[model samples]
Target: MPQMAPLYWLYLFIFFLLTLLLFFMVNYFIKPFDNISSVSHDTKIIYKSWKL
Candidate 1:
């Protein structure tokens, strides 16, 4: 039977967790920008309509 070092497993787990954390962090940061852009677009449309 071959034995694997426990630290290798820990390293793999930490790497996977970091990857997941980074993905969610990027998603979280991107959502606010999308909302801000959409809100600004809506406001522009509203102002244009109001002017006409």
Candidate 2:
């Protein structure tokens, strides 16, 4: 029925959060962006300022 010290819990919580963040950064963002869109259609940009 005893409680923990405030600083102890705070430090542990912060450490756990930083560990989780590092795990995610090592998992997801360390890879290149994969091109999932397989569309081969042509895309054009027309200048509206030159149009009559």
Candidate 3:
């Protein structure tokens, strides 16, 4: 059991790292779409302001 401790810890660390990587990847992919939608909304607002 003592010999397995390090391997167990390593697995836990790797799992944590993988979770963080996936979280970042999800956020990274989502942000671009959010930004694009916001940009379009902003452009529409600007056009409306110009019309007013």
Candidate 4:
């Protein structure tokens, strides 16, 4: 098998880092929406308790 060059390894590393960054960015954006939905659901439950 042919050995890969150092530049190719650098490119791979950069690609991996970018992939990780993109994953975190998506997670960050999504996490707030999830939290908001959960918070709203919890508040509904709390309101029901207050009415009881």
Candidate order, lDDT descending: 3, 4, 1, 2
Looking at candidate 2, the ten consecutive residues that score lowest on lDDT are 33-42
Weakest ten-residue segment in model 3 by summed lDDT: 43-52
In candidate 3, which residue ranges exceed 4 Å CA deviation? 32-52
Candidate with top TM-score is: 3
Clashing pairs in 4: none
lDDT of 1 by residue, 1-52 (tens): 2356677888999999999999999987776666767867876644455674
lDDT top scorer? 3
Instruction: Please give, for residues 1-52, the per-residue lDDT of candidate 2 as tens digits.
Output: 2356877889999999999999998978666444333233234445689778
Q: Write the per-residue lDDT of candidate 3 for residues 1-52, one digit (tens) a residue.
A: 7999999999999999999999999987776666667867776644455664
Candidate number with the higher lDDT (2 or 4): 4
TM-score of model 4 vs. true structure: 0.57
Worst 10 residues of 4 by lDDT: 43-52
lDDT of each: 0.79, 0.72, 0.84, 0.80
Off by over 4 Å in 2: 1-4, 30-52
TM-score sort, best first: 3, 4, 1, 2
- Candidate with better TM-score, 2 vs 3: 3
State the lDDT of candidate 4 residue by residue for 1-52, as single tens digits: 2476877889999999999999999987776666667867776644455674
TM-score of 1: 0.53
Better of 1 and 3 by TM-score: 3
